[model samples]
Target: MELRHLRCFLAVAEELHFARAAERLHVDQSPLSRTIKELEEELGTLLFARTTRSTRLTRAGRLFLERVPYVFTALDQARASVQDAAAGYHSQLRIALSDGISPERLSRLMALCRQDEPDVAIRFFEVPLAQQLKGLHEDLYDLGFAQSADVDDGILAVPAWSEPLRVAVPARHPLLAHKTIPLEEVLRYPLVMGDPEYCEGYCRQVDRILRSVDQVPLVTEQVKSLNLMMALVAAGYALGLAGASQIQTCRESGIVARPLDRKAVLTTWLLRPDAEAPESLERFVERVASLDAERRLTT
Candidate 1:
């Protein structure tokens, strides 16, 4: 019913223990318990099931937990909008990034936006692909970029740009003997891949490539970022697969990026709600298209 109720509910739902949640909230256990009880009575549902030894969320609690974080996100965005307005920004655009989008490309796009429209405040949120899609639908984000185009009906996905997928090899590794590594040879060694939960779009793209080969890959580890994957590859723990630009930007030493004998490309898509766009959004989309065109011309 109130902010405090939501806050207390979230704390307990996350901690799953009343005393621990109270400790986290810097409150006494009795008050925290009372707050939870008050919230439950108001909602007319049991949020948590507790026993002497354990506490866990009921079905209703789990469902409520799903929608609670968005409350805080909305509040934060509102605060940020006020701050941006005070800073003399006429408007704000919330853009979400998912699936470990290429930093070089994003920087170029952001620089272009700043140069073309200095009055517009561009805010970026790095979230998982699932969250990105949900935010787009909920109007939390105006647009998003990701490696996967797969989406539900309410969202539209269009290819913005693409880069070649390359294999990241450690220095002095046997695979480096070949200038262009074959897929079969790359799969023979263990690989460090992106975790699906964090990099769903990226994982989907990479998984499709891996599935093309008949042989099974030996994945040494699943990491959440390209930096970690490159680090593992640099250390000779395993090889890695990533976009060429991503491999080029990685500062880790002893990592060599080799192209595949066969061509493979990863495409980044611009995702937005499937509805009529405002003039500003239309201009932004045009800028994206022009940039991609320029890149193709120069490349």
Candidate 2:
């Protein structure tokens, strides 16, 4: 009839004795006897066979006991799941990232987060700036990381960190002639760029800087990630643009990096909806902003 009735029935079914079931339930034997009688009367069937020496479950009682326990287990599991979500503890934290990110830097930030919140799950999506903007507003992501946040004004974007825009050059490029090349001189040559659609946030700034100097850079090639950008540059396609941290990620072969005119700063931003964020989101933003040092890769 009620949850308590189901519980009483389950306990009595398990023990097969009124006295023992009463003790297990922390109730008096008289109450236990009354509860079983009430359960049987409600169900219109005898639940147990009783004798002076022992008590045992009937066919119906055994079946019901199995079903009732399963129902309770399902209810308990659902309750726990809700509590976990309300506490801002998800099995996974869904993240949307802009392309051209330095894998090394991203890995380091993740290691720090995991070191503290071991149970937090990390699910990454390589999303374009347009997708990040739309999905974040619709409550589809817990966080969004971008080379810059120039696309959306509805989202609260905070500068999390910055890395120098390194120009990855081939071994014999004239640009490599300078230990730390200047931006103006580098722009004179064609530039290989990441897809502007995905990296609109970063490329917009680069475009602005180039326009100020009245330079229309020749497009040599297009790439997605910093690793690929560096690879293309190493093959001598054209000069490449990337953050200093990215250069560190791509220092595998003949690629070389130097400051591009006073080390043009490439900023990383922590993005969330402009509306009030959950405590979990706030915690992530805070941890990212308080990093003690720069990015590093983990095996």
Best by TM-score: 1
lDDT of 1 by residue, 1-299 (tens): 89999999999999989888999999999999999999999999999999999999999999999889888889989999999999999988889999889999988988998999999998888899998999999999999999999998899999999999999999999888899999999988999999999999998888888888899999879999998999899888999999999999999989899999887999999999999977778888999999999999998
Off by over 4 Å in 2: 1-91, 151-153, 292-299
**Model 1: lDDT to the true structure:** 0.92
Instruction: Give every collision pair in model 1.
Output: none
What's the lDDT for all of these models?
A: 0.92, 0.75
Q: Model 1 segments beyond 4 Å from truth?
A: 15-31, 52-54
Q: What's the true lDDT of residue 38 in model 1?
A: 96
- Model 2, residue 294: what's the lDDT? 35
Global lDDT for candidate 2? Answer: 0.75
The positional error of residue 113 in candidate 2, measured at the CA in angstroms, is 1.4
For model 1, the run of ten residues with the poorest summed lDDT: 276-285
